[model samples]
Target: MLSTIVLAFQRWDGLSARRFTGLDNFAFLVKDPTFWQSLENTVVLFLMSTVPTLVLALILAVMLQSAVRFTNVYRIAYFIPNVTSLVAMAIFFSSIFSTNFGLVNAALRSLGIPQQDWLGQPWGIKIAISTMIVWQWVGYNTLIYLAGLQAIPKDQYEAAKVDGAGVVRTFFSITLPQLRPVVLFTVIMSTIGGLQTFTEPQVMVGNSGGTGQSGMTVVLFFYRAAFLDNDYGYAAAIALSIFALVLLFTAINWRIFRGRSEDR
Candidate 1:
């Protein structure tokens, strides 16, 4: 972190002599339209990815918590994406969402549905990347939720059942309230990961972040500034901005959850 802060003041291409540029890099970032675009895209992707992920993960956790055949197999299957190589998975998804002659387009065309350029268009690219994010994280979040589920005394469910509470009623009144701490952790973690998202976008869309720069996440923006543009100072500034953004969001989420916990 200190190294990044120091680098933020020095204009040094990796191979060139360092020139102290002070706040110029930061000033330039302020006016850089692409940087702002990337920031916006990052936030959009965060919302697109994280919300459905938590919902699906919670549902999966609840389903798996009930006794089921091949439960362990189901758990491992869902978790494989979380443990797989992100670059490889990104490449795989790129093929799946490929504009022409790809499986997705082929299937769509077979059904007489128009094939959209998944990675070529702005919104499509964001959706594709967000899909990858959800797939990668859902299982991990599921496990965390499952742990929280286990911690809830079995008698809570028994009591609810004795009171003639339905599954839906019990889930909202007992399950979610008890899972607050786990939800808080997942939310903050998802926020940080979403803001720092890089690999899937970079791998699927290339360094330029595809058409309209929709795949340009904040971390990807930092990578291009540092490596492709050889603007270390600017990259450092972006890095700091990313850090600040994460910190701010995490603090906000913490306060919201903490307040709820206190109220409860």
Candidate 2:
């Protein structure tokens, strides 16, 4: 963190003599259209990927918590993506979203839909990236939620049932409230993961970030600046920007969740 702050004030690549350029990097970030585009894409990816992941993970967790056949097998299957290499996963997804002969487009074509170049447009790139994000993290979030669900004593359900509570009633009146901590945990994790997205775009669209740089995320932008452009100071500013963004969102999340807990 300190290194980033220091780098913000100096105009030096990793190999160059350092020159003090205090506030110039920050100024450049504010004025750069690409930076703003990256910021927008980052936020969009964060929300689009995160909301679905939480809902899906919770649903999966609840299902797994119930009596089911081959429960361990199911869990392992879901968790494989989370433990797999992200670079490999990103590469695979690039193939899946490829323009001419991708799996996704092929499936769509089979359904009598027109094939779209998913990596060629802003929304398409975002959708592709978000899909990767959700697929990668949903299992991890599910496992965390499963742990939380298991930590909830079985007696709570029995007590709720004994008191004439239905399945929905038991879930809302006991399960969700008990899982509040886990919900908060997932939200915060999602916040971080969503913002720090890098590998997907890097491997999917290269540093150019596809058409109009739609796939350019903040971290990827930072990587471009630090490595491709050799603007270390600017890269440092972007890094600090990401740190601040994450911190801000995390605080907002805490407040929202903390208020919910207080209400409970």
Off by over 4 Å in 2: none
Model 1 residue 228 lDDT?
A: 89
Span of ten consecutive residues with least summed lDDT in model 1: 67-76
Instruction: Please give the RMSD to the true structure for each candidate, in Å.
Output: 1.2, 1.2
Among these predicted structures, which one has the highest lDDT? 1
Q: Candidate 2 residues 130-201, lDDT tens each?
A: 999999999989999999999999998999889999999999999999999889989998998889999998
Q: Give the whole-model CA lDDT for all candidates, comma-separated.
A: 0.92, 0.92
TM per candidate comes to: 0.96, 0.96
What is the per-residue lDDT of model 1 for residues 72-134, given as tens digits with 9 covering 90 to 100? Answer: 888888889999999999999899899886788999999999999998899999989998999
What's the count of clashing pairs in each model shown?
0, 0
